[model samples]
Target: MVGNRSCRIAASAGLFVVLAGTAGCGDEPATQIAAGSGTTTTSGAHWQRLPDAPLSPRASSVMVSSGTEVLVIGGQDTAPCPPGADCAPGRITRDGAALDLTTRTWRTIAPAPRPLLGEQAVVIDGVVHVLAQNHGPDGYDKPARLLSYDVATDQWREAAAPANSIGAALTSSGAKLLAYETSHEQGLVPDRILDGGTWRDLPRDPLAPSFDRVMVAVGDERLILFAHELVTNPGADKPSIVQAAEYDLAKQTWRRLPDSEIIGGWYWSHTDGLLVDPSIGGADGGQTGNYGRVYPEGGIFDPRARQWRPLPALPAEPSDDLWQGPATGGPELAIVRGFVLDPGAGKDGRWIRLPQPVRGAAEDPAAAWVGDRLVAFGGTVHTDRKSAFTADTWMWQQ
Candidate 1:
C-alpha cells in the first residue's frame, strides 16, 4: 500500500484519467469518455467518441509496440454459441499486423512461427522480445523459451529459455522485462522468471496471490503490478486483490501499495497510469511537474496523496442477453476481472478512456501504448466451461 503520506497526496486535488481499450465486454458494450472538473463525477465529465480498430474478436494474443506501430498478435476467436451452449474450440493467430496511427491503417505482417498462448512480449533496445510456450508438454508444466522479433526486418529468432515456465504475465520496466510465475517447482518451492530468461526466488505472499496478472510502467522508472487471488468457486464474497506492490527499477526494490490507499477501495481487477486531462484542474491542479496518475477501477489511486478515491459505481451489470451466450458463466460474472488504462492523448500523456471492453479479459492481457492509442490483445475470459480463452483485439485512442 502507498505510505500514509502518499495516500494524502492522492486524496488531494491531483490530476488523473481513466484509460481503457476494448469492446464487447458484455451485452451493453458502450464506450464512454467524459471530461470532468476536479471533482470526479459522471455528469461533470464530458464524453468523446473515436474510431475503433478493425480486428476480429480474440483473447490471449500478444499486443506490444515496434517503435511507432501498435502490433496485435496471436489470439483465439471462439464465437457463435447459444446461451448455456459450450463454446467452440479456440483459434490461434499465426502472424501479426500493425496499426499506423499517423495514417490510420492496418498492415498485416508475418505470423508467429510457433502458435501458442500464455506468452508475453516487450520491446527493448528496439528488439521485439517474446517469452512463450512451445506446442508440447514442456508447455504444460515447464518454463517458456525466449524469442526475439526484429520489427525493422520482420523476422523471429530464438533466444534463451527461462529456468521455469514463464507465466502468462510479463511487462517491461527499466532495462528488464519482468516475468512472473507463481507455480511451484517440483510442486514444492515458489519461483519467479525475470528479464525474459532469468530466474529468482520470490517471497511467498501471505495474502491472495497468483502470477496471472500485469505490471505497468507508471512514471519514468516506476511500475505498479496488480496481483489477484481468484477462487474456483464463488461465495458470499467474491475474489479480489489480496495485495498490491510498486517497483522502482532504478532502486531495484519492491514496496507494497495497498489498493485502499491507492484506490480508495479495493481495485477489483486491473490498473493503469493516466496523465490527468489538464481540463480537470488546469494550472490549479495539485502537483505541477508530474501530471500523470494511476486509476484502478472500483476507484482511483492518487499517487500525490498516496490515497484512493472511489469512482462512480460501474454501470449496473448488463442484461442477461448481453450476459448469456459463450460469455456467461457463474453468477460471479457480474464482477469485473480485467481492464486497460490508456494514455490516449500521447506525448503529453493526455489519458482518456478507450470505450472497448473484452468480456472476462485476462488480468494480464498483452497490452501496449503505441503512439496515441493503447491496444489490448488476447486474454482468458469466463466461458460456458466456466473459464474459456479469447483471441479478440480491441483498440482506443484519445
Candidate 2:
C-alpha cells in the first residue's frame, strides 16, 4: 500500500521537520515510510523526524541500508477497522521499499521473492543476504529460503537457506552471519554460522537454557548469546535469571560471562549491538568477546579481566509518559540501550542508548551494525488487543 501525507510536528521547541504518514491525526494509525529528506531541527539528544513517504503498517519486519538507500521487508500490520480492533493496521506485508537516505526520498521495490513474517537479513560484501523460514499458522519449518538482493541490479535472487528449517533472531559477527532455532520439542538444538556460502554448526553451551534468546556478534572473533526464559513452568522456582555467554569462532568455544560482568542492559531477544574496539591491534587482541556497552540499564564486560562491570545511569527515568511512552509500551521503546565498542580504537567508545525499543512487543529484537550505523529489526509484543509484531526500521548514528 502507498500513502502520501505530511505534518510539521514540534520536536524540541520551534524546530519542526516534516512528518508524512497516515498517523499523527485522528486515532493515529501505524504507518511507515521508505523515502524523504530534510534538515535537522533540534541539535542534541533529540530525534528530528526525517521527511519520508508513508509506508504500510508492518510489525516484526527488517530494514537495512544498501549504499545510500534503505530496504524494509516483512512485517504484519494490525489496525482495527469496522471489524473490531483487529482492522487497524491491516495485514502482513511481504513487499519491500527503498528509501534514499541521502536524498530523503521513497520508492517501492519488487516484493520479497517469498512472504516472510518473523525473518531477518544482513548486508555483507555489498550484497543484502537474507536468512528466513516460512511462517504459517501452525509454525515454521525448514526449507530452502536463503536469498540475496543486488543493490546495483535492483534484483532479488536465491541464497543458501539455514542448515535447519525453523529459526529466529539472526545477527552478524565479523565475516559470519549467525542464527539459531529455539525448540523444546525434541533433541533438536539448531545453530549455524554462515560465511562465504558455508554453514558451520557449533556446540551449544550446556549452561544455556532452551528458551528465547538473542544472538549478536561482539568484536571480530566472538558471538554473544543472551538467553531468557519469560515464564517459569510448573515445577520451576521462579523466573530464571537471563544469562549471557560469548562464543569464540576461532577456538570454537563458548565462555559464559557472569551477569555482573557486562555493562549493558539485557535487550529483548538479547539484541545488544556490538562495536569493536578499534584501539586493539587487529582481531587478535583487546577485549576478545564483547567490548561494547549495553544501554538503558548501563553495564560493560571486560574480556581481559574476565568480569562484568556496571556503567553510569540511564538518561531518562523509567515511567509511562506520552512522548516517553516508548519506555512502557511495546518493547519498541526498549530498543534504545547504551552500546560500547568502537570500530576504530582511535575513537573512544561510550555507552549510548538507542532512541526506540528494538523489539515491537516484549519479544527480543534483532540487530546488526553496517558501517558506523547500527540497524535493528523485528520483535514480538503481547498487547490487550492481540499479539502483534513490528517492522519499523531505525539507524543509530555514532
Candidate 3:
C-alpha cells in the first residue's frame, strides 16, 4: 500500500523542482545489448525516475504522450469518498495531470468531463481520443462514451458514441483510427474513424465467430484480426482453434490468410513482423475465466509472406499466479518479465534485463513510447486487490 503523503503541488500550475539526487531516483543502470544466433540481445538502455506526479496515488491510469507532454488521465484513486453519500471504498477520479518532458516539471490539467475507469486513449492527428466507460453512481455496467481532448487548447469535447455499450479495441493505421468489437449478437464488424468524430463500419466479408480476438495494425493501411474459437464438444480434438485475416483499408475488404500454426495472444507490431508473447490475461491467466487459452507459442507473423515464423523462446516463462503480467513491448522492442528483447535491431540485438524500480516491481503498468523514451506509470504492486495501486513513474531510454 502507498503511504498517505499528500501531493502538495497546486492544481493547473507547473511545479518546478530539480530532480537530481531525489530519493528513489537512480542513475543510469548498466544494460547489455547483444546480437547472435536466435538469442536475446543486450542494449545500453537504462531507467530514470522522474519527479513524482502531482496527484494522489492511483492505478489503472491511462497515459498518452503528445508532442513534448505526457498526459495522465482518469484512474482509480485510494482517496476516501466525501461524507454523506454511499460510495465504494475508493473513489474513481476524473482529475488529470501533465508531465513536461523538456522541462522535467509536472502540472495539473483540466479534469475529465466524467469519471472513468479502465478506459483506453489513442492519439489521432493531434488530438487524444479516449474511449471512456461511464460508471455512474450505480456501477460500471453503463455504456461506453467517446471523449476527445485537445492537447494544444487543454479542452475536452464529447464525440459521437459507439453503437454498443461495451468498449471497443482502439488502434491507429496512419491517420485513421480503427475500433473493433466481437459481439455475439452483432458478429464481427470493425469501425473506422478517419476525421476523429464520425465512425463508420468498414465494408468487408462476414467474419467467423470466436470466443475472443486480438487486432493489430500492419503498415499504414492494413490490420490483422486474430480470432480464437473454443471447441464446445467435449469429444472435440483440440481445445480451441486460431484463425487470422488481413483487412486492406484501401479496398475496405477482408481476406482470410492461409491457415498457419500461430497462437493468438497479446502482440506488438514490429518492423519485420508482429512480435507475440503467447501469454494471456496477466501472469495469473485471469482472462481464462472469460476467454480460454487458444495458442501458447511465441512467434512472429509476416504479413507479406502471410506465414508464421517462430522466434526464440522468451527467457521468462509465463507465470500462473500473476494477472496480465506477460512481457509487453512496442514497435521497436519487447520486455518479457523484466528482460528486454529488441527483435528489430537485427544481429546487434540481445535480451537486456531491466533494473527493478526503486519502489518495487511494477504489476502490469500502463506504458507508452514517448519520443525517444518509454514512459510507464501507475499499476498495482503487492496483491491483485485494488489496495495495491501505485503512482510511481519510470522511464527507459537507450
Q: For residues 1-398, could you state the per-residue lDDT of candidate 3 as single tens digits?
A: 11111121111111110112223545455355354334434456666878789877676677787767888887777743332334564677888888988898988888888785656677867788787876656545666677888888888997656677363767778878767664333344455554546677776433455535556787788888775543343113332334678888888788987654543344444533553543322211233232233334345666777876555444443232211233455556665444455555553345554554453443435566664476777765552333355667777775
How many pairs of residues in model 1 come into backbone collision?
A: 47
Give the backbone clash total of model 2.
53
375, model 2: CA deviation in Å? 9.4
Give the runs in model 3 whose Cα sits over 4 Å from its true position.
1-25, 28-43, 79-89, 136-141, 165-167, 182-196, 204-206, 230-236, 239-241, 270-295, 315-327, 347-349, 362-364, 381-389
Runs off by more than 4 Å, candidate 1? 1-60, 77-84, 87-91, 134-142, 166-168, 182-214, 219-221, 228-241, 259-297, 303-305, 313-396
Residue range 1-398, candidate 2, lDDT tens digits: 01111111111111111111222221211211111222112213322233443455444556665667667776665542321233333466667777675666677776778765645567666667777566554444446477777777778887766655454456676667776765333445668887566777778774444454556565678776655433334113322333567788999988877753221222322213422111100111123332233212223344445554433222332222111111110111122213223211222223222233222223333344444444443343445666544433444444
Candidate 2's C-alpha runs over 4 A off are 1-45, 54-60, 77-90, 139-144, 182-188, 195-198, 228-239, 259-299, 302-305, 319-398
Error of 1 at 237 (Å): 8.6
Candidate number that wins on lDDT, 2 or 3: 3
* Alpha-carbon lDDT, every model: 0.43, 0.44, 0.58
TM-score of model number 3: 0.75
**Candidate RMSDs in order:** 12.0, 12.9, 9.9
> Residue 228 lDDT in model 1?
48
Better of 1 and 3 by lDDT: 3
